[model samples]
Target chain A: MEDQLTLGGRNFSSRLLTGTGKFASHTLIGPMLAASGSQIITVALRRVDPKAPPQDNILSHIPDTVTLLPNTSGARTAREAVRIAHIAREAGCGDFVKIEVITDMQYLLPDNHETLKATEILAKEGCIVLPYVMPDITISHQLYDAGAAAVMPLGSPIGSNLGLEMKPMIQRIIETSRLPVIVDAGTALWSNHQPVCPPLYLRLLFQPLHLLRVQCGYRLSQNPADHE
Target chain B: MNININGEAVETSTPDILSLVRARNLDPSSLVVEHNHTIIQQAAWADTLLQQGDTIELLSFVGGG
Candidate 1:
């Protein structure tokens, strides 16, 4: 038997999804994707800066083999998120859209209500919606009912580097949800010291915990051993 | 004509979307143009003309999580 993660009628061999953010240089992205073996990568859409110097397009760095998962990061409302999703699809970024509706700026906690609303609308629009929400079992079920392809619950606040702060709640969600549960943010394995385990090791460790998948947003180091 | 591009008002004599992009020295293949809140496909850029007070947005993929 082979292990595969399926989303939106497509099968992916690697369960780890990577993001194209916080990188020191765009040159590191290609090698990082190659090393991580991530089949799906997340990107954000923004207005082109007119004053900025001409540079290589971010899409040019990403190989055609990988799937583009464009996120609605800047949206604060369901309507805004829906608009971004439509634009992303029309821009030829495929059907995958990650619904991230954050209104709380201080802690950057996701507004579950707006996220659910966006999920409902985008899913109905034939998008493969993956909503990032707070770790709530009821909300997970609601997302599934809303036709979401997957439910991404945060382990903690975004980019807090606090690994699995809401582990118990996330565990409950993973246990009950029929949809794929992806641990999206605040699961970084660094804290002023060298990481105890590599990313591959962490993936194997997560098996007993029943974590379906994980998305990492760490910068890729030159040395394979120097895992962030 | 004056138009709103990415929330900034700009003055230009460029007629079509393609010409406007060229005038700004932007790569057409690397852009997604939104005219008056509707995404205009690259293939239609040559046909989609700009109008005064029209809102245009030039979007591209960026590094984000």
Candidate 2:
């Protein structure tokens, strides 16, 4: 929790980021957000029903306390992702865009070339681009050079529940990256396998932090201000 | 028509800066100015001008971030 995660000029106090989707109810999201201690909340842009009937805005349920990260979840190409980013901005999400270039349906791996291209163009257009990419150190460096504020590598394919299979690559990326390394997708929990933590160059997505705190058997104070 | 340039009166023998700039073959990027306290963009600066005491300020691009 003490790790510093800086993106787009704003320094976030917590590394844990939660998604606004998959919650049972909108009411449950609030408590989950509080418990997760996430400063950023990722929202799948494709899920937002902009053309919904007056009484049924799915996005209306999301509380304002969490900063929304509109992700291009369903986009298979850079062009589609860029178009979705424009749509998100028009919907008042502004230039804060998460570039998700998952082309493969089975593995959900990011297309490094398309992701790099999208990142360069989006960043030049003043969009704060956070790209979800593969755990390749070279690709991560290329994305960083392309002006991505953060690079999110998947631990495994989305929803497979496989945790940190690319530990060696993740370790190398964390060591050399100038941008934040956000481990996204997969798994229910981080492995309690290592005591000598790899010197993290700013990790994001708080599930790991929470697990660490719990592992230490330290009870965090309930005061919101103290933690926030 | 009469035009003002930095509080000084001048008459451009044309309607606007665009026509004048075009006629003179001037590059719009070489100059910077402000219209009524708001900075006129480089692309639009050549078309902007003072209309009878309309406030105008001239600015030059400097090398720095």
Candidate 3:
């Protein structure tokens, strides 16, 4: 077994980190979390509808033991990212934040310059920052100095589901990184030949949760775990 | 007076930030406030007095990845 992965002074037995983005139902989150055994899950902060009723959202579905990693997904610049980070922390999501600064709307690639700037600022302000980048080694080194708890490099474009197109670059980053290299996207283990489809792949890949020792979502029409 | 909230200009006679939240039917405990781009703690909502042209941002956590 891969030993426990440590980040932000906390030891996580399940290296697999999951995201709650494309689930068909928010109510399914708890059961999905139970099945995957992910220690850390990501959530996005947003403006509450003042006119609407306060319906229970994703926060209510996730287990209390799982760490809530609020991501700055919509931030397009370092300043905006810094602003969101402050809001997330002040809202009691704690100091753990995922810095995702993406300006290119086409590919949705993470802007390395803006992310680096945000990481420097948030880290100094006592946040356990995890930056999602386009897989660059020099930037990873810089983020480590900025007190980043770990560096999350994309396996492919965000939500592309292309599956590790950047594997070579990601390997270089993992090899050179001073901090833990948690592959955020495109880490799913599936090929077209398998009887298990993408949804099943999404669910079961994380079920071998501890295999990565420091790692590991998207959408699907059906709940993937139904196959088992 | 007109105060900008979440980028929409609105006229309100609310005395303090807490009242604005209450007037909007928001649960103060469930909302996170940013006044003029600076975070205002929930405990300080009563202490945070609003003024004309103040920018108030109300945020809450949602499902994301």
Each candidate: chain B TM-score: 0.94, 0.51, 0.94
Distance from true location, Cα of A72 in model 1, Å: 0.4
The candidate, 1 or 3, that scores higher on lDDT is: 1
Q: Which stretches of candidate 3 lie over 4 Å from their true place?
A: A49-54, A186-228, B27-29
User: Candidate 1, which CAPRI tier?
Assistant: medium
Query: Tens digits of per-residue lDDT for model 2 on A26-88?
Result: 454455557656667665543212233222233454467666677877788898788667666
Tell me the whole-model lDDT of each prediction, alpha carbons only.
Answer: 0.82, 0.58, 0.76
Over A79-106, each residue of candidate 1 has an lDDT whose tens digit, in order, gives 9999999999988899999999999999
Candidate 1 local lDDT, B1-65, one digit each (tens): 99999999899899999999998999776788999999998889999988999999999888888
Q: lDDT by residue for model 3 over B12-64, one digit each (tens)? A: 99978999988888866557789998888878999999999999998877767
Candidate 2 TM-score, true structure as reference: 0.61
lDDT of 2 at A211: 14
Candidate 1 regions exceeding 4 Å error are A195-217, A220-228
The 10-residue segment with the lowest total lDDT in model 2 chain B: B56-65
